[model samples]
Target chain A: MAKKVNSLKYEFIKGLWVENPVLISLLGLCPTLAVTVSAVNGLAMGLATTFVLTSSSIIISLIRKFIPHQVRIASYIVIIATFVTVADRFLAAWFPPISKELGPYIPLIVVNCLILGRQEAFSSKNNSGRAILDALGMGSGFILVLVALGGVREILGSGAFFGFTILGDWFNPWMVMILPPGAFLTLGFFVAGVNWLNERRAAQ
Target chain B: MKLILLFISAAIVNNFVLSYFLGICPFVGVSKKVSSAVSMGMAVTFVMVIAAAVTWLIYHLILVPFGVEILEYVSFILVIASLVQLVEMFIRKVSKPLYDTLGIFLPLITTNCAIMGLALFSVLREYNFIESIFFGIGAGAGFTLALVLMAGIREELELADVPKHFQGAAITMIVAGSLALAFMGFAGLISI
Candidate 1:
């Protein structure tokens, strides 16, 4: 029915904001907080994650029916790990600087619960097409958050966006924005801000 | 003496959880109780040491020799996953009580970024076999220290009336930020 199609659309759309992986689910906080010291790092990490996520979702969807229920989690992880390997190797060989900047995080993507959580929750149950769409939506949402975090940190920390200076001589960088503590503090406030916005919206 | 300093620096001066921000998931999730946190920490330490040893051999002996160092991420992840499963089964068969305590945490360890991060860092730093093992133990101990301290704070925090928006994860993060700042004092202790 038309209603079914509409609901499928809703499922894909919701991941963008309503249930954003970073803000709402709080999944994959490791990379989100770690690699966002620069906008370029965030973009690279986000795109790499998207590649793994989209590819794994498609593959999982194609074989969802054949995978045994108990072993599904293991299967999804293996698939994800394989794709991550490819991404990591590609980055190291082609983009060594970004790879080094990201450090071990590129490999850490394998265990990112966001990808596995999606496979278990949505991809396993849904058809291949819907799963791909949902994966894309969620991946895009994650990328947006990474870019925003990276932009804020990069601009404030070094007066740059993606290695290009956005702030002029008048601006003095907040040195903490590039440090480990800044990651926690910034994300903490960002999450609280998201919650506050939700509350106001609901009240309205 | 140098090795001991490496261990101490990694474990305390540059803690994986508090300073480096690796493995925040379990740092927050499993740190609700002191006992559970201790168990999780020990389990992580055990796997990390083994993983460090195994991955070092794989990287230096196998991957590098084959000129396929590019496969490091893939192989490391797969190795960690299988290692977790192997350790879980071995523990269950050998020690029931220890298995019971570490039962749920074993599977969770597979996803703990600290394990994978330790492996990658070991290779990146080109640490030798013994150094890698020490790094693993140090990172594990660091993770445990952070988790237990956070749990202790949370226990006391249960009494405090946190602001509405800062409750739960938000407040936990802010507290962790302060802890990270405190840990920063140790940074100057070791030049490495």
Candidate 2:
């Protein structure tokens, strides 16, 4: 029992960093860069994604035995898309402002390679419990990165974090940090940070 | 004139890759080589054009009329997946050389958010049929332009001695960040 728990714990923990979907695997980047202009938006997108990722992963894991190899990809997409639709509508209904800000991105989540990749890789091969753990790990990792990236961009661009003022009148907010370039630049450095950490860990 | 402005806007001012951040997988993954980037661009543009037309019809004529508009996400994705599959098969049958060039990319295009984003954007913006097509072409052109530019720079970057940490995708991303900065200059150049 202890051994089983340990392995499962590793499955979940790996996605938090070592096999991070965003930083390490670099999947589902379009949404990462698009909606992460602000920390709030990043957190919203991350939670929405986590909901879909966890839900779909559990479903796929449950049905893994029944899915044939040839049609598995298609089956996975439909399953994934269904959950995305739910998330999209849920956001639109409950959070009108976030829904509008996120715009087509909610629907775009249907195509997010991160969700689909997890289905193909983790869920399809593992049990529902492991799939759930994996989904949460990856989801948290994704959320962590988004919130950090968004926090950095927001603080620099608007002199605020999560809509609260951080920098004073003396500091000039860099408009470029909130624009498209900032997304890439911030994410680039974040990627570097992850790489550096991994290298340090490896060397030791 | 409106169509032309839309095209230019989509292609330059509001580039899909730079502004909207769509189809980034191919932008980063396949952009290492100029040759492969061009090929991927062509494949994506071809699908985008067709997807624009077909999705417009589906959203307006089919979904709207049937009152099943909530099916938009599921339907659009299904259409794109099958469309790519069908296009791949048709290309393989119709022209060997063309298929040889684009075959590998067709499979990858299914998950490319840009194509789906284009469809959703047109629907959200309430663009008419012709405008949607122009937008598709423009987005594709913009994607191709970004990919080609990134590829060219990366080819050159192959020689530059880079730091140990910020290499590979990390460096590519920073370079893209610079390109995006340049593209931002075109922000108010035109508005349509």
Candidate 3:
């Protein structure tokens, strides 16, 4: 029982830092880069993804035994698409503004490699509780990177935070930071920064 | 004129990769070599064209007729997955040379959001069948153009003195960002 608890803890924690789905694993880049134009958008996208990831992880874990080996990939995709549709509709109904902002990306989540990767790699092999924990960890990690990226871009690009002005008047916003190029540049530097920290920690 | 604008717009102004951020996995994963990049682009183009055609029919003929639009996502994805499988087998049987060229990238197209995004975007825009086909071609062309450009830059980037941490995917992204910025110049070309 103790060993099982420790393993679950490891599985959960790994996604936070050691195996961050975005900064480290690089599993889901499209949504991570595209929808992160603002802090709020990033937060919404992350939460929606977390909801989908966690829910699908639980369901997939529960059905692991019944899924045939040959058609597992197809089954997983259909399952994921169903959950994504639910998330998409929920967003559109409850948060029309955010749903409009995210646009097709909400549906694009159905193809997010991160969710499918977790389903295939973890949920397919693990028990329900452990799989959900793994999903939570990964989803949290994804949210962390996205929010961080969005915050940085938002603050630098427009001197705003969740639509509130954070940077002082003296600071001129880098207009490029808010553009498509900015997404790539900010993520590039941020990824390099993460790598540098990981390497330094390992060396020490 | 409108069709031409749509084709050019999808291919350049609103590139699927730079602007829409679709197919980013293959953009980063298979962009190491120019030869492979071209091959991947062609395979994706082939699949995208077929997917666009098929999904339109599925949406218009069956889903819309039956009033089951809610199943669009699930059905579209399943169709794409199975279509890719069929394309793979068809390619292997009909033309071994083409199959050899495309190799594994064909199978990888199943999960590529660019194809699905193409279907979704065309549907979202309410594009007619002809426009959807042109949109697919244009998007595929744009994806190819970006991938090849990145691949060429990466070949030269191999020798450039990139910082240690920003060596692989990081640099690739930064380069893509610049390419995206360059591609942004075309936004003023057509205002559709």
Candidate 4:
């Protein structure tokens, strides 16, 4: 509470890596781990989340005053669900393959704590400008982590990066990387790695 | 036979927490004590079963017949949110002890994602009413299994010398990764 948070810059920069929704804050982990099997899927999911998140933030911010406090969460859920439907339908129509690959996870985004969390924490309290910026920053952070995770998984599982063969012919792909464990293992290590990085940065 | 297979598939083979990553939040968040975990699991199970049956009815009876499937996400979420509220009030009125145990977790269940995922999955699988109920039970059971297992291990982990950086969420995830590997053995155990 002590740090100056009034500037718009604070809201935007916080989500990129400082307080990353996935790696740091640990708000939205379901979709983060589920669809990160490939970089493409991760990017699509991230973008879709970004759209829903930003749209809901704008609407929630505008109607923040009108929503009764007792039923505010319900209202937020409805607002979020509306945008999620829009994103889900848009994805299905424009990109069928990725949509199929992501499957229920897209609609599952409505319940993603990251989006709802931002609305409750920042959007409901802040103005629309800050809400949009917060959404963009957090969404970018989520996108970055997903792409990194998916890229790593894809490379290890298939000896390829984004569908291109990266490892040599002699490389023995860890087929387990394609399975569910790969996601948990990769994320586990990534979180530990991020912690170590922060520790070292602080030691300096 | 199909119902049995579906039940086993969702429970063990395709665990909601391990394979599908549906409810990782509670899997990692509330899985600190065996007792609380058990309570959360029961609450989630109750909601999952009911949510499955109700959402199935809503989707098939109302959304599909009226060609308003577009409202699927909105309506399903609304149903789940309100359902949790109703279930919470009912429990508080019926049993004091049970309500106290599941007090905090009930509201949180609105955002659990597992229930949402279960509803979405039943729709995707196109299970009939009975089968959907079975699937709900299986998913809830599987979720409980994962949460309780994590809780038990974490209770023991309280004494272990976890690494400095991997102490909190990191270690839990690694443990979960191992559990997932163990659970993966169930994969293809029954090809049905």
Candidate 5:
């Protein structure tokens, strides 16, 4: 029994990198691709998702024993949706511009598989403390990927980072880097590049 | 005439899948076979239309009247969830073959994001009931178009020799990027 609990830590840590939500699991790709055109947007989205994920995970874990297996998924979604509503309203009321830039993607967080996936896979069976840890790790992993993608796109597309100019007049922005195609191409290469790095590491 | 423009604009000019990035999970997951893609498309279209109508009423009748607009996300998602359940049972009882075709996809539609995005976009744009319906249909058509086109490409891609790393999702993304570039031609069509 003690050994089993120890392995839960491993599961929690795996979500942070070994099976990172954006990079490895490949869940929640829509928001990951849609909102990363700018670093600020990406950071805001990541934090918003983290708030929802962490809160919902704790709630679900606390109530996991009560929810029926058949209706567990539905229950989890309702919990997530409720938290998402809170996050959405908070952002809209306080940070209207980021909310506007994010558009429907904010509400679309309810549909993000990462939050629900963690609840079903981890929180439902784990204690509250473990669930919280797992949620935080997964949330951080997601934020890391979004920040990296956002940084790349912002620098290449606008020669800026987080809306501040880093590259001077010598830099001619690649207009495509900020467009829809840029999102897809950049993510594709990023995935391939990550896989290449992992392969090299494994060989050594 | 207005409806036609709305349909065309949603379906082509601002495609939900390619341009807006809605319904991408199914756009990637269910686009492997043309038949399943069609089924998934139809299921999504059905859900989107209902979601738009229902969410519109909820927003106006409930959220706005009560001044609890903060509950929009919670209410919209709940509405979508129950609606999908209702659609599933209705299909299962009415027609077995239809249910089988759309069975698994129906539950998935509850979280498709395209349906939710349609509802949210309609509200954001302040469209009337008729316009919202049109928007839903148009978005569905656009999703279907992209899914079918992608399925066709992937079918042929099976025969081609591809690099190992770019085999599964990387190639799909690269292809989708090109497709997005192609669709950008329609950007000049509608000013919206």
Candidate 6:
């Protein structure tokens, strides 16, 4: 029906703005805060998560009916862990430097609440087509926020963007921005900004 | 002396929550009240110690010896998930009062990432059995310290007229940033 198709489109678009995972749902803060100290690291982490999220979404959607109610959580985790291992090994074998930079985080993705949350919340209920769309939508939203966070921290903390000097000679990088405190502070402001924008849009 | 240094480093200098960002979920989610934060901290610390010991054995004994180190992530997560369940069941059987306090938080620990980070970090640093135990205590202590401090601040923050937009997690994160800045003072105390 036209109504069903429109609702599906709404589901996909919501993830980008209305239901931005990092800012709104706040599902996966561990990796979001940890890896986004730089743009590239954030991008790598986001992409790897996207691959895992989308693949796992498809698989889980397909098998949702077969998974017993009692063991569904465990089953979902196992499926997610398998894909995470693949992503981990691929990164280590190919992009050794990026892999090193990410350190344990690539493996830590196994516990990233976002991927698990998606499977539990969206994929298990929806058909494969909608599950895939939801995965891609949420993944894109996650990637966008991560890249933005990384860019803010990178430019402010290091006076660079993706390792390139963007702020020029006049700027003295705020060392704290690249440090642990900076991650929290930048995210805090970004979250506030998103909330303000949403409030204003609702008011109109 | 060496063990003391390792403990101090893990607890203060290189805190799991503040510096490494291991357990932000519970750090933010459950720190609404000091009492619950302490409860969650204890549960995590308890699991961290057991997980460290078990994971170390699995890696050094099963995975490493069998030449299947590639199963590290999968195995570690599985170990942690079941361990949380085991700990939950054990507590319910042993003490009803204790379970009442920590009952809900037990299942949530499976995805806490702090436990998994503990397992992975111990392995990464190649900490032996004894060192790993101490490391678990230290990290858990650090997590507890941060959670309790955050809870204390948030209790007062409820009274403060924070801007509406930064009311929930946003404000908490900023406070955490300031706490992190304060924690950085400990960096000079130890190099590691």
For each candidate, the alpha-carbon lDDT, in order, equals 0.89, 0.93, 0.93, 0.93, 0.89, 0.93
Clashing pairs in 4: none
DockQ for the candidates, in order = 0.67, 0.88, 0.86, 0.90, 0.76, 0.86
Query: Worst 10-residue stretch by lDDT in candidate 6 chain A?
Result: A1-10
Residue pairs in clash, model 3? none
Cα lDDT of candidate 2 equals 0.93
Segments in model 5 whose C-alpha atoms lie over 4 Å from true places: A1-12
Candidate 6, CAPRI quality class derived from DockQ: high
Instruction: Single out the weakest 10-residue window by summed lDDT for candidate 1 chain A.
Output: A1-10
What's the C-alpha lDDT at position B156 in model 2? 98
Model 1: per-residue Cα lDDT over B68-116, one tens digit each? 8867777888889899999999999999999999999999998898998
Q: What is the lDDT of candidate 4?
A: 0.93
lDDT of 6 by residue, A75-110 (tens): 989999999999999999999999999999998999
Lowest lDDT sum, 10 consecutive residues, model 3 chain B, at B183-192
**Once superposed on the true structure, which residue ranges of model 3 sit more than 4 Å away at CA?**
A1-6
lDDT digits (tens) for residues B142-188 of candidate 4: 99999999999999999999999999999999999999999988888
lDDT of 2 by residue, B66-93 (tens): 9999899889999999999999999999
Q: What tens-digit string does per-residue lDDT give for candidate 3 at B23-127?
A: 999999999899999999999999999999999999999999999999999999999999999999999999999999997899899889999999999889998
Instruction: State in Å the error of residue B148, model 1.
Output: 0.8
- Can you give the lDDT of residue A72 in candidate 5? 90
Report iRMS values in order: 1.3, 0.7, 0.7, 0.6, 1.0, 0.7
Put down candidate 5 lDDT per residue, A78-175, tens digits, no spaces.
89988888888899899999998998898899999888888888899989998988888899889988989999999999999988999999999999
Encode model 4's per-residue lDDT on A32-89: one tens digit a residue. Answer: 9999988989999999999999999999999999999999998999999999989998
Total clashing residue pairs per candidate?
Answer: 0, 0, 0, 0, 0, 0
Error of 1 at B156 (Å): 1.2
Chain B fold agreement for model 1, TM-score: 0.98
